[model samples]
Target: MAARSGRRRAIRGWLGKACTVIAAAVLVSSVGAAAAPAAPIHAPVLRAPAGGYEELWVPSSMGPIKIQVQWAARGGGAALYVLDGLRAPNDHSQWTSDTDALRQFANDNVTLVFPVGGRSSFYTDWYRSSSTNRQPITYKWETFLTRELPDFLAGYGVSRTNKAIVGASMGGNAALVLAAHHRDQFRFAGSFSGFVNPTFPMWNQAMRAAMWDEGQFNVDDMWGPAGDPAWSRNDATAQAERLRGLPMYVSSGNGMPGPPDLPYGAVNTVNAMALEAMTMTAAQIFRDRVAALGIGARIEIGNGTHTWPYWRQGLANARPMILDALGAH
Candidate 1:
């Protein structure tokens, strides 16, 4: 009997140890659960003075998109979206850096909206991930610009419908595409030194080289193979009929240096000359297509290169048209 009692006490001792271990495990789990970090909360931070140049962090599916904005001088509702070239920087826009865009539009009674960062993206939605390199997320720029951005801007008294878009180089093509597709959003569209005819023979090759040079991005990842319908869809020349009744401005250089290239070195000037020549040819083709469709657009071809001075002048020339289209003084 005493032995039986001893065995029972031994089993109790084992049960007590097991319970203690289980209790310690539960305590540790509870402590760990309490110690876990919480999910981060994101909020938009505004920088710069009121009614002047301001930076806004807008939320999107890809991530937060930085938008540099110059508010209308007299509280006007009209806004102008200025897009950057192929090698757009992440922190700020080239428009603000290269030109006096902020001061030029400070009293224009039109808000200037510059979307920062889109290197080699062409500001379009991609078919898949970047083939040449790994991207953190699939680019959904079309949706962001057309839907998310406009929705956000509407809250700050900027009209979603009354807006103008202008771009230089790669951005110029994207502006035309966006205006052609979303006519209701834009009343005026301008392209300065853009390869508007992307589907042309050897044009895809040129684009592939440029994209690769800028960010090692694969052109195939943008809209699939060269013959894909997306290529034709994004081509401004191919979609010229859609731009009917829309006031538009198109300009390119004649491969020769004008006053702007005088300050640049020989190599820079030569490169600009070659690029401008190619873009001019494509712009001419696009102009012919628009004319054939009875679409009246302001086309300017002059002696200059693919440098920023000409583009800055182009913007200045188009400012009056933009204000008139948006009725923004």
Candidate 2:
């Protein structure tokens, strides 16, 4: 009877200690909860551009992206989306910086939407599980450009559904892909010196090299392996059928020095020549494929290299066609 009484007392003492520990844990949790700080604000900010353009930071899954827009002269019923080249700067659009795009379109009755940044992203969605060659952030640009940005711009009197898309180089490639995939949103598409047929032999290697130069992004993370189906799926030549009946303009240079070429001894001109040569080959393949598909498109080949001057010329050449398609006065 004495042993049983001792055992009962020990059990009761252990239960008392367990309760004390539980109470201590509860107290700590309550204190910590009370001391927790409030979450930080992440609202999008808008700033007016010095050149009369309005800039807005659009919130997306990939965080807030900056968009520079020149509101329409006649006020908001149509829009033209002008995309950047391979080396897209984070500050402003090349259209505004390199050329007189804004001043030229100042009187045009269409909002010129320019998405800034995205150096080597090609403005498409990425599947990045590894960070060896690319960043770990999510790239849902296809969603941002097609849906999120349009939906947000609607509140600002911009017509969400009525729009035309144009791009140069990398942006050119993405513009066609986006237009082909989402035909309902874009009525006209233009590509100037863009590498359109990326699935061609040795093209993926070139792309990888360019990406490494720009941001060290992985080609595989972009759409998957070179042999992956996405390579062909993203190729505009492969999807030429979808672009049928869509008003399109395709332009590229022969990489030879012309009016817009830099001085003969300039190394940048030599580099431009080499780059545009590759672009011409790919663009020709795409143009031929589209022609074979019975898609009537305006294709222009000029004696120029891959420079901002040539791109500006191409945009000026395609402007009337784009405005006509959008019925913009």
Count the clashes in each prediction: 0, 0
lDDT of 1 by residue, 1-329 (tens): 00011111100000121112110000000000011212222322222344346667888988999887877777777899999877676766767766666666766778889898887788899988787877777788888889999988877778889999999888888999999999999999999988799898767776776666555688899998889999999999999998999999999989888666665566556666767777799889998898888999999999887767788889988989999999988
- lDDT by residue (176-279, candidate 2, tens digit) is 88899999899999998887888887677767666655556777888887888888777888888889999998899997877655332355456566667777
Which 10 residues in a row give candidate 1 its minimum summed lDDT?
23-32
TM-score of structure candidate 1:
0.84
Candidate 1 runs further than 4 Å off: 1-52
RMSD, one per candidate, in order: 21.9, 21.5
lDDT of 1 at 107: 69
**Residue pairs of candidate 2 with colliding backbone atoms:** none
